[model samples]
Target: MKIKNLALAVAALYAGSAYALEPFVIKEIRVEGVQRTEPGTVFNYLPVKVGDRLDDDKAAASVKALYATGFFKDVRLEAEDGVLIVAVDERPTIFQININGSKDFDKDQLKKALKDNGLAESLIFDRALLDQATQELKRQYYAKGKYSVDIKATVTPLERNRVAINFDISEGAVATISQINIVGNQAFKEGELLDLFSQTTGGWFSWITKDDQYSKQKLSADLEALRSFYLNRGYLEFNVDSTVVSISPDKKKIYITVNLSEGKRYTVTDIKVGGELLVPEDEVRKLIRIKEGDVFSRELVNESTQSISDRLGNDGYAFANVNAVPELDRDKQTVAFTFFIDPGRRVYVRNINITGNTKTRDEVVRREMRQIEGGWYNASKIRRSKERVDLLGYFEDVNVETPQVPDSPDQVDVNVSVKEKPTGNVMAGIGYARGTGISFQASISQSNIFGSGKYLALGLNTSKSSKLYSISYSDPYYTPDGVSRGFDLYYRKVDPTQLSLGQYNTAGVGSSMRVGLPISEFDTVNFSLGIDRSEITLLTGAPQNYIDFVSAFGSRYTTLPATASWVRDGRDSALYPTRGALRRVESLVALPGGDLRYYTLSAQNQWFYPLSKTFTFMLNAEAGYANGYGGRPLPFFKNLYAGGIGSVRGYGTGTLGLKDSNGDALGGNRKVVANAELLFPIPGLKGDKSARLSVFGDAGSVWGSGDKMSFGDLRYSAGFGLTWVSPVGPLKFSVAKPFNPKDNDKVERFQFQLGTLF
Candidate 1:
């Protein structure tokens, strides 16, 4: 007890003496262990300068601030000869970052994204920031169906305040949909339910569209679509109780369970109308296709209301509202619907205003407006005007808005805005084909020069087999009433192969005038007249077949062709077609002053349909025939050959018809062709619109000496093709295999071709 008392007394005395001692006066401050940091930086953080008293509290504060800079791992202060020394160990930054498990995002993209968020390589590592980054990456992966992915980060410190980081990742197998079970769906089978989902099991074209790439976003959208589908089909009380997604232990397979409560099907028991109407009630009711007893279809109800509103607008009530309300009857399992119509103040358009068209002339845009002052408003015409503006191809987006005039109930103003897009193109390129060898082409075109919405083009093409030069100009609104006018002038020269017709050469100049009329929003009809004259040259090594064709035809060819074309273009864009149709019928007659005379008629049609979001179907058919009417046979230069990239595909160019003595096929005067294509995006080029790949099947026949072309003589081919809408123009290359080959066929089984702007 006595020794413990003596020890406590001694400790107290030592503490008191230490506190009573005077504070150290700093003579000089010294810093060490810093290679990049300047001496001034360390001195600036030191509160006690030379000849100042250094206290323990000030020393502690300086150390804390230095550590907070995130540049040092260890900091210390020592006093010697009244001088203070501060030492620091700098923290190393992460120099290299590696992530091991990622399937949804590109590694480089992720790295860049992280860098933008202050997690770049060579930046000092922070445990808290890394945790947040990991969570963010995981969330993104979950959105793309990598819910089971694991990320491991390994960091190594290098010399010079640098560290190397490696993220060892185990991106587990993707969870594919194995089954989707929907409960309480008695009206539709499970297969039908599955069909409604964009994500599905593998199909024959699974490799193309990749519909099996399961994603949570897609699943959520599909669920919403299912809900809408039911509600729109008279299932008013339908509800999805829960959606449970289950994954296997290996994470390779997934199962979805949807619990649904499908309430009783309801029938419309009553219909009520309300609100003021400018048009007669009978007229408005006539527009509603739905009857009282018809099944309660949300689509029909909404469509009927829209029709009523549109009808009111046609009656000069531009600002009108028509809405459908449903009242439920629990006992009868029926619902009564009421369409409330409000034909708001019948206002006149005092003035039509146009804005946002800096480059386009005001008159040019105003002329396209369907609504005009001193005229009754027409909703249909206004919508048509919007479509016309869109079809001009000069604007990225066009919008029309009606802003009401304050205190002027009977007057309103309309504003139209347009966003301009690049509408001019200049292209020059070189290409090669089996028959043409190598060809060069150059073209310059402007769809909307100076925002006038007119089209002008000048082009030149030269190859071993042919040469062409052309100039064209078109005005969509030639007279400001939307009537289209165009004219084209062209010159072309064609030289036949030595094996065909004694190496014949033909040069022709032609001119055409065209007039177009809009049949509907989606259809246009065009009429044209063309006159052409040709001079023929017979070179050395002339074949007997060529001599026969030339003797039957005239030496100086002169013809007049009349053409009528119908185009139903519903495609979103002209350059890249999602769906549309192009059809034409043309007839040519040889002039009386020409060396040879004949009357020929031809018809062609093509249709495109989108099979899915990423798949499309294209169908084409054409037929042409000519017979001597006033003079000899049709000119050889005008003959059609059905084999190549643009034709039968499996055979060489101009090799599908009749063969001559030298086994070379003679071009045909009568031709028939049918083709179908199933198009899909190349796997890695999904968002790339310039290049596309597709599979096609072609079948066609040609007749030279025969009176009538027979389908039995038709040749068939199947192939895969690549289409590139390059800056220079469209290029088509194909590799084909013939399905049927005759004994005397000299056409190669495989062929390649590149076609420029038509």
Candidate 2:
């Protein structure tokens, strides 16, 4: 009976085995519904593999791992006869993207924006991303003050689980700010506070500048400007309480109000410096702009800190930090400032990195850097390096950053990033003028040739009065010291009989070799040697002077000339100078071997001074004198001529020179011209220097041999001129009336040029 009980107990122990699960080993892993993904990719992401025991936990984890790859939207796992199966539904791939009805923004811009928002071509499509992209496009247009912009997105499925997304955008009318109100102000009037803002209410100039448009960036800038205005005027504790902006129901009008609390004005009681004085204390004190007993000015305090930091930077402390701590005494309304300075370790440049130059050679860019590698980090040198690169005109943008090297406290890497511009230009143009007739021109020029810092130009021009064929080559860095060498060869034919000038023609061939030497930061000295051969031919009704010159010296002559010139340019910009001066002096002499021996001296100077925020005063003067030497007369063809766009704008080309017996202009040997202009941005296009309007007054003249070059002999005109750097090229237009003209002067009131002046 006991043995029977033992057997029953054993049976009872085995009875629970029926409910227990047996471990099933996976024999193989199978991936289904994968159209583009590789089978190995699925296996790599699967948590449960072949020969592994499958369980609920492992199955769940494998499903999660597959979903986490972002390649599948739905995943299912099943076990059939110990073989694990992973079934997935993949998200559709983007086949094509189209954007329509977008005018204010570029199509590429929108595509890039969508790509940045995770909705690019060939990327797995997500419904949430499509919705986000639609809203993002709307936000972009709204930031430009297009409040009524509407954006719609459509997703159409293709055959092989692919989708085509189309974004249709409707950019509505721009929203303008109708009024800007400044409230809670006592010291300054509303008008005064509003005047300080670049953003204004609607005005006559709103259409061009669009300053009245509401933008978050502009609003933030205006707020900072408001703060600076109050802080600079001795308001020590001024606080901007609140700002309220409201738009009308139609989204066309905007109103803004800023509330502020004006604190008591404070005056400076004393100022002192506190820091590790690596330099003498007195030298640091001299750098401070704020003095005791002056009105507390935040600008001066900031200037003082910058001055201290710059002084330290100049002394090799590139990472210096200077701060101004002000202590205010409420009882006396007094403020005292202490400038704290920390001069960090003197850093050196460890490496120089150049980027974003896909076409230019690395050495070509490195040669322009002023901050040498393995040298002390000088901020001024770094800044000059960027400036030098910008002056190359090979790049549209140039930026430099000095990032400290990791694990090296006193070492930094200077990185230069540049956006390259088109270095070569091919131009073909046809121009017309009353004085010169119709002309056809074509030119090919490249400033950077095959990424080398070399220049080449080929040109051909055909005109009723002149025809030219020329070629030139230049190497800016002929030597390491920044010397430039170049050569020019040209053939030209001038037929004055086709125009209203003298009835004579001349054909010539010339070649010249030139060198430029950099003398200082803003100065250069150039020397050139040239040889020329010309033959003159007389047509019907040729001028007597030309007939006399050809009769005296024969029809053909060969000459050699040498020239030396000095130029100093301190202008802030080369293309559009706003404030600075340019001076050039040159002397040219024909050698004794030439048919004509003559010397010419010429000087040109232009100065620009900013009179206000918008207006600039410019003064330009030019003088030239040429005379014969070694008992030979100056070549008549080489005589100076004045008038036209480059001289007196209202007069015809070369019309202000000496007169001949046939009431035609005769070239002269002496010339003087003076011009004064009030330059300012166009009324609506304020701050756009690329397009400008100038009110100018010009006076100039030409004088023959033995004729005096005097101010009284100069012609005068007053006019306005427009200049634009357009998509095609630089354009200039002028309209003027001569102030005082002789009866014989040819008046050309309106003139314009397409390519270059004169």
Candidate 3:
């Protein structure tokens, strides 16, 4: 034999004496020292099978393979009488994961982090994995700028070969951004560029908003914002060459420096539409927002590209590609733009799959879809469908995805995923106004009852001055054509003397059934008819008008009231509107056959304009007119009342109308109110549209019978208010100073309205 062959044979023979007396043909394989793992699993992992000849090399190879499986901490192999024996000391399985001392994130979040690092419960306990999980936990804190965070992991072995993994974490304070410097910039000032970033160096509100924290993700986003800022300002060749971030020795302070190169500003020299124009060239050209001589704006260029693509998509071209290729003339500092459009194959939606509904019914969401299955994919329709579902207020979030079906180039599936919220509420609320002492309200309501998208509410409102009990039901989709039907039944009692409005007591019970017909996408017409019985009693200090009203109309009366209204709502959001306009007009007529005959007309218009992402401008106006009909006096109870939260916030509720002989507000037959507000994001809660602060100016007046309503007689007030959509419902508060107030105007400088949706 050769020298190498002789050495290998001698080594194998010597090594065989360690565990096996002699090499023999294997008859069977058996695994021992395993508690949870199956014997078959050990067999499948063995390199040598039952029929294989056992030798020193085979024994060593089998041991190595078993150890590599990670299921065993120790492995041994033995051979006896041609039988292979495999032994393993299995690693302890993780029985539970525990986290402590983490306030920034919850226990579940930490467990998820560990799970992502392969150190979750039921997983094998490996020291390497535990160390990795520790590092990952620290990394999460570091991403949040918590440089002082400390994380320690402990493994406690328990009975049944199981262990408990505990992660004790101390998430430290966020590192503050002490300074931000911009270098190698010539076109824009350092201050100007810094203002574009959401991360601030340090401010008074920094602690609340944490906008001054040094976070990697925030820094990355700020860099992108800077790039966009430069590009939008005509610096087409702006480039961020390098960025340097440094931390203090204590790891509590951070400084950032960015080096940038802003090349020569470029202007648009010419704009042209090239490539295939499936639509008319003129129509496509109109879609381009950029024109010749305008500064080169990357945002506008991208918007134009997306617009062209969307236009093509609307025409059944779901896979359209539109690119704005810029041809730059460095010498002239100008760019010639060319829009290339490619309308690919028309794709159709094969199915509209809805998931994550959980509680909401399939049809409830499907009915809101404007894009039908087996129809051409329309991007606009899909977007509108999402918006409609969002406006339903039954979901916390809605997401739509379009994925191309495999092996089908011209077909796609629409996946709609929704996160449901608490649509049913049973709550009680309390509020206080300057003049009105306190009010208590309780309600139970469901916007999505049993996932049917039906609204049901039962409420009781009790105040020192008034008491009301009401129940309402609404079916948003009463008909396939999108008509809505609803009904309201209410029993209300009002005591004006207790609230400082007027001296009278009125009790009424009424029911109304209404149907709303969709006239257009943004318009609806509603009709309702109801009968009410009201009883009025004059107190010792009752107003003269109240006594006169009772003398003419009697103490008890019944009336049939019919109403027709048209509403056009274009608001972007239902809960907190930021843009668009809403206009409504309604007329109510009490028939002549009733105890009292009267006709009332009212119109309301509101418009919202977004000045910036954080600022919005809103204007609202309302007017009402009431008169007697069929030779009967107008019912005093049906008169229009103004002032208070929905009208003029600085004044008492229903206190802006004409006064009686006792100088008490008697309400009126004519009313006009207008308000303008500047809405802005709360200082510490930027980007949260649910909470807003606004400065408003209000002007309104109410004119009684035989009186003329004019702008000159309006009451004016200016104030600041906060509107918040809290967990319970919307809460509104205002603090105002009246510009013009009579001696007995009953002005309320502070007013608040709070109620649960239920």
Candidate 4:
């Protein structure tokens, strides 16, 4: 009787065994209705196996386990002839996903979004995921201010139990901020406060700035901006209580209302220093910008703390902490500030870790670093190191981080990570101009070849008037002291008669070797010497002066030329300089060995002053003088010419110089050019360097040997120019009105070039 009870208890322990079924020992198990899933997979999920005793409990458990796998839509089990048969209907797989009418987002991006939301191709189809994907797409568009977006998802059954999903979308118009109001009373006027916000109601410039568009992100930023504005002006207790946003019934107009409290303005009553002043008290006092009796400013306080911290960091205190603890007296509307400084352990750099230079040589990058390993950590050196690496042009981005060494309080590691960019360019272009017709140019240049940081360039250009071929090579780090070496070879042919410039043509071949010495962080002095050989050919209608010059010096001659130049560039960016200055002073002389013994001196200075984040004022001036030496006249071809787009924009190319008897421009030995411009960002595209618009005024001219240099002789013009860094190349177009022009001057009201300017 006890053995019988044990058997019955074991059966009772089996779950869901109340529905009685005959017990049987399974000899084999067969899976059915599993076309996609393998038989073994069904068996793995099955609770009962071959040679196992089966009953109603086991059968129910097997069906539950198979259903939990979610791979099957229907599951069943049957016992026949002592063999267990498992059945399952596999869910349909997603074969393809199609999205149409998606102009704002890329198709791949949409697909990826769906995949991240648990819906994509080649996955089990779920009707819930289709709705989820639709919502996700709508949410993305809504963030961009598109509130009326409509999405229709369709699931089409395919062969082999697969399904295809297609999302037909109708993205609607952006919801514009029709009105914005500040509900709470404020010390500042509404107009003044609105100016600080990134969002705004409709205005003349709204189309360009898109500030009228309502976005949650922009609203949050505006709130933060409002908070900062008040805090910067002594509103110590300013708070943004609430922000209310609403959209019209049509989903095209949005209104924003911000409620805020304007607290009492505070004035600085006293300033003091405390806590481990490693430097002299007087020195620390000098760093504080806030003063007693002045309006309290959080920005000023932050600056004072940062200044103190940096001062300590200069002395190897890499972990220095500086904080401005303020005490407020609401009754008197006064605040007192105490700058507390903590000069942590004087740490040194234990290791210099460099990464992300997968293709570039490590030594190539290490050479540009100014911060040294195993040395006292100097913040200035670390900053300079980052700047040096950033200016290499080999990397798209450079980042430096100094992290403390593990388990070492006085040791740190300087990590320099770089993102390499393609340093080579292969460009081929065809251009047209009235002066130079049907021009073709091709160039292959690499600034970092084979990751060696060597420079090489080969170029070929031909026009109706001339043909040029050149090759140049340079090693920027030829010596440890930051000296650069380079060589250039070029062959050229000119037929000025082709463009009616002159009835003479000359072909030349020249080679030069140059060395650049870095005198300072932002300055370099370069010296080069070259030899040139040219043969002049006087055409049938050659000018008398040209014939006379050829007769005097002979047709064929060789000259050794030497040049020296000092360059200083302090601009914030090379491509789009908004602040700082660029200055170059160059002198070139044809030595005694040259057929033409002459010397030329030139100076150019360009100053870019930033007026605002998106506007700049630029001033440029250039002057050059050339004269004969050793009783040999300066070669006519070497004479300076000014005009056209790069000089006086309204005048024709090379037309600002003296005119010969044949009505062709005769370049002179002296030149002067000046330009003033108001530069600003392209509408709707702030901070985009690829394109810019500028209004400019220009004045320049050239003087012959017999003519005297005078400002009165300079050509003057004013115009607007557009510069676009297009895929093919940089394109510059300008339309100018000449302020003053002589009747003989060729007036080119519009000019454009599809290549780099310099």
What is the full ranking by TM-score, best candidate first? 3, 2, 4, 1
Comparison by TM-score, 1 against 4, better one = 4
Tens-place lDDT per residue, model 1, 1-758, is 00111111223434453322245777778888887778888777666688777654555556666777777777766666766777777777777888766666899977876676568876777766677776777666665556688877667868887877776667765666787788878998888887778777667656565567677788898888888788778888889999898888877777888899888888888887877866677877788877888777777888899899888877778889888888999789899877888888787777777777878777777777778876666677778777777766778999977777789887777777888878898878887676677889898999877778789999999888788999999998887667899999999988767324225788999999999987766677888888888888765555665677767664676777666766665656566666877777766666566456676778888888999767889999999887666546665566777777788887777777776665666677888999999988776455567777889999998898564667788999898988888655567788788988898765565565565633
Best by TM-score: 3
Per the 3 Å backbone cut-off, how many clashing residue pairs does candidate 4 have? 1
Candidate 3 minimal-lDDT segment of 10 residues: 1-10
Runs of candidate 2 with Cα error greater than 4 angstroms are 1-43, 50-115, 119-127, 149-174, 185-212, 229-239, 261-271, 279-304, 329-336, 495-503, 538-548, 708-710
How much is the lDDT of residue 269 in candidate 3? Answer: 94
Q: Which residue segments of model 3 deviate by more than 4 Å? A: 1-24, 30-40, 53-61, 73-81, 87-112, 120-123, 150-173, 433-436, 756-758
List all candidate RMSDs to the true structure: 9.8, 6.7, 4.1, 5.3
Judged by whole-model lDDT over C-alpha atoms, candidate 4 comes out at: 0.85
How much RMSD separates candidate 1 from the native structure? 9.8
- lDDT at 725, model 1: 80
Residue 77 accuracy (lDDT) in model 1: 64
Error of 1 at 224 (Å): 1.7
Ranking under lDDT, best-scoring first? 4, 3, 2, 1
lDDT of each: 0.75, 0.85, 0.85, 0.85
TM-score of each: 0.66, 0.85, 0.90, 0.83
Residue 72's lDDT within candidate 4 is 73
